[model samples]
Target: MTVTVDEKRCIACGMCAYAAPEVFRIVGSASTVVAQPEGKSPRVRDAANGCPVNAIRVEG
Candidate 1:
């Protein structure tokens, strides 16, 4: 449920926050990981996949 967004690649698109509000948020110019995604939830993967810049990464 670990979610991380690369600062260098994030574009603040807000899709991560929109798709996985529990785990992600847009802060200023970057997408920030707010909390870990729930176990086996599709939201996190969806958010990661939705990132046009491929900035979001999920582990475990």
Candidate 2:
């Protein structure tokens, strides 16, 4: 799976990184995913869903 962050919608709240530090980070006022969500780990998906602005997108 792949995780993409919508910079436009990102508020730099750092929720994604907080939820899944392995998969996400706050960089230059934006949220970025450093790892791929290939396994069954729900961290990435959870972060996406937890985003208040819906800035994260996950694709398998």
Candidate 3:
């Protein structure tokens, strides 16, 4: 699976970064997508769901 964050929709609350720092990060006060971990969809989904602005998206 692949994870993406819509920079426009992101609030930079650090939810994704908190939930899955390995796949996401708060850079320059904004949420940025990092390397997607292998076989880590569930964790990514948790991060996405935790996003208050729903800025995170997961794709297969």
Off by over 4 Å in 1: none
lDDT of 2 by residue, 1-60 (tens): 788998988999998898889888899989887878667668888888899999899887
Cα lDDT tens digits, model 1, 1-60, are 687899999999898899988888888899888777668778889988889999988888
TM-score of decoy 1 = 0.91
- In order, the Cα lDDT scores of the candidates are 0.86, 0.87, 0.85
Give TM per candidate: 0.91, 0.89, 0.88
Judged by whole-model lDDT over C-alpha atoms, candidate 2 comes out at: 0.87
What's the residue-level lDDT of 3 in candidate 2? 87
Question: What C-alpha lDDT, on a 0 to 100 scale, does residue 28 get in candidate 1?
Answer: 88
lDDT of 1: 0.86
What shift in Å separates residue 17 of candidate 3 from its native position after superposition?
Answer: 0.6
Misplaced by over 4 Å in model 3 are: none
